[model samples]
Target chain A: MAHALEPQAKTLAETGPGASFGVIQGLDPRMRIVVASVFSIVTVSLSTIPGLIAALAVSIGVLLMSRLPIRRTLKRMAMMDSFIIFMLVLLPFTTPGDAMFNLFGFPASWQGLWKATEIALTANAVILSLMVLVGTMEPVTLGHALHKLRCPEALVHLLMFTIRYIEVLREEYMRLRAAMKVRGFRPGTNWHTYRSFGYLVGMMLVRAIERSERILAAMKCRGFSGRLLLLQEFNLTLRDYVFAATLCIVCIGLLCLDFA
Target chain B: MHIVDGALSNPVVIGGAIAAAGGIAMGLKSLDLDRIPTAGVLSASFFVASLIHVPIGPSSVHLILNGLAGLLLGWAAFPALFVGLLLQAVFFGFGGLTVLGINTVNIALPAVLTWIIFGRLIAKGTPVQGAVWGGIGGAFSIAATTAFVAVSLALSGDEFLPAAKLVLFAHVPVMAVEAVLTGFAILLARQVKPELFYKGASA
Candidate 1:
């Protein structure tokens, strides 16, 4: 029953559209990831409307420079916006403050509106920064960057393997779902439905474990060590440094404005 | 229940991150070399499990299955869930990187707790008994996660109290659904591959 609800993973493009040709894409993947994360921290820390607006502008500017696929980004933003919209609707009535308006005789406060705006703007700002910076780099590159940044080696390896096998497992799950559908399995709130879905997930895990054994054997045959060694090396160039500096300065300026 | 970025106050976020870091370090230390592949495979299972949505009364909610992960993996559930959350943030943007620590702690802590509370019961019981306990652990973990998420939000500001209450109320249905689902899953695993549960016990 749960298998019926599984959505396919998004098919990643060779290089994400619009991001392929962007100036940000030209920077080191490590630099982009670090800077984007720093920017996101700043955005999340923001409380003031003016500070949030400034951060949103910076995010938009980066998005325009990155030239990421606008339609896709907007679609994702719309999905996230649903939560923001819910918060906005609820906050006004629930938050106690100087009443700014009334909806159906319910008091809506200025403070509520401001808080919602802050949350919505900050969410957008951080998301846009991620779309431009982290979204542009390949997953493997990002994994390598994380490894280089001295993240736990086990974690790095686990991330890489998970990425490699997610699609395989999803495909396996789809096949099982198709088979169940052929047998006229319909999802409902019942014991049979729950048991069947449980079997499906249990079967998937069984297959995954077996496949991992084969994978480990194959890696050993190829002289694989416990640590992952990448052939590609990243060097920070002058342009990369400049990009980092500019992003940091912009973020720091936003923080200062919030204080001001 | 993922807490989105910017929703949490600095102290809550920072505190969650530190506590989560400690959990992950402990998880890493407990993760043996032989179990690395199993950890990765289970992590992927968790990653893909979120795509499975269960339709309840008026709406549908995706499966978290953190309970199943914990029942099988024990403390190792930490890194597995962290990786899944990381990928979800990067690819789907369901949660953001800045709030990863809080989100991880909220979701995974209950999983670890489930193991602590139910691990022995599940290991020692008959298949039916295991299934019953699994259901309790499943429902209990979701309830715990909702509380953590609510606390994280309410701690941020009084303005979020309503949202906090709503978050808990909304998940009530999900809790029941996951309870049934997890119960059945444990029954199946016990019949076919009881070793999975015992492995966690020994660990």
Candidate 2:
């Protein structure tokens, strides 16, 4: 499912307004990692309405500056919002605070709603920041950044393989799923067929592993090295410096906005 | 659910990070080259489990065999999960870097429990029965771990209840899907990969 959408996501991310502002399109993966980590921390630490609002404003500003088409970004944001709405709906009924109203046997409180809104918004912020970070950065570059951070070597190796194989797996999954669909394995809305659903997963897993083994064997036959050698130049040029400086300035500016 | 970095209470993230480090260290200490096939198969199986979804209510959820992983790999599931989630984070962005530790613990806890349960039941001589328990054990373990994660997030006092509940409730349907899928997965192993379940069987 995810594999099929990769090309679409990659294009939308690159061509969208977020990409246009050069926020995600130009930054080094290393710097994007730093920025994303910092933003997430700051967003989580924020509690008050003013603080959240300020953070939201900065994120929106960055999105706008990315120069990707606003409509494309909005469409993506809308897709994300639908998922957020599920959480939003639960807040009014389950959360307790200063009562705002009694609707359909549920007590809706102003405080609860406000807090709920914050949760949803912050969740959006987290996803949005991540979108920018990933959209702009290359996968291998990010992998290197992880390596540079002294992340476990085994983990790095495993992660690199998983990412590399995800596309392969996705393609394999699609073929199997399509085959199942053709075999009339329609998953209905009923619950009884869920058991069969489990069977389907088991079969797919077996097939995937079988396929991976073959792939692994084939690679070995070719004397495949474990590492994926990146061909991109990693020189820290003047442009890279400027990019880092701008991010720092933005971070400082956001902190000041939160404080002030 | 992948817990992103900066989402958890600093203490939870930091503590999880330490525990994960210790777990991986332990895994490496016991690591044998012969388990390569087991690790490879289980990892691939784990990856595929997430692809097929079981429809429930208004949403759909899929099988994720952190429990089965634990049953098969025991302590080794830690490194496997850590690696698996890190890959998921990078390739699909299903999770993030900072949340890697939390997600690893969430998935590994079940895998370890399943391993323990598998050990006990498989010793009883009925491989089928062992597989059944292993399946249920895997499902319940995942649910328990998920709930624990939810509670931990709520306790972080970041006004996380709504977000937490969203996650918890979403899994209600997913938990059932995982339960059924786990059972079926174990059944397949019992038939075709019986050597994987039996201690002395030749691979």
* Model 1 Cα lDDT, one tens digit per residue, A1-260: 11212243345533343436369867888888889889999888878999999998998898788776677666776677775576668987888999998899999998888877777888778877886687667777778999988899888888887777777787788799899999999887667877788778878877777787788788778877677898679899999999999989998999999999
Model 1 chain A poorest ten-residue lDDT run: A1-10
Candidate 1 per-residue C-alpha lDDT over B1-203 given as tens digits, one digit per residue, 9 for 90 to 100: 66677777899989999988988888888776567888888788778877886666566788998888888888889988998888766766567778889888998999999999998888676998999999999999999999999999899888889888998998898899888888888887788888877877778
Span of ten consecutive residues with least summed lDDT in model 1 chain B? B52-61
**TM-scores of chain A in all candidate models:** 0.89, 0.78
Give me the overall lDDT of model 2.
0.62
Off by over 4 Å in 1: A1-10, A13-21
Minimum summed lDDT over a 10-residue window in model 2 chain B is located at B194-203
The DockQ for candidate 1, computed on C-alphas, is 0.56
Question: Candidate 1, A200: how far from true, in Å?
Answer: 1.5
Off by over 4 Å in 2: A5-23, A65-86, A92-96, A104-106, A189-192, A211-233, B1-10, B24-45, B57-59, B79-100, B119-127, B157-173, B198-203
Candidate 2's docking class is: acceptable
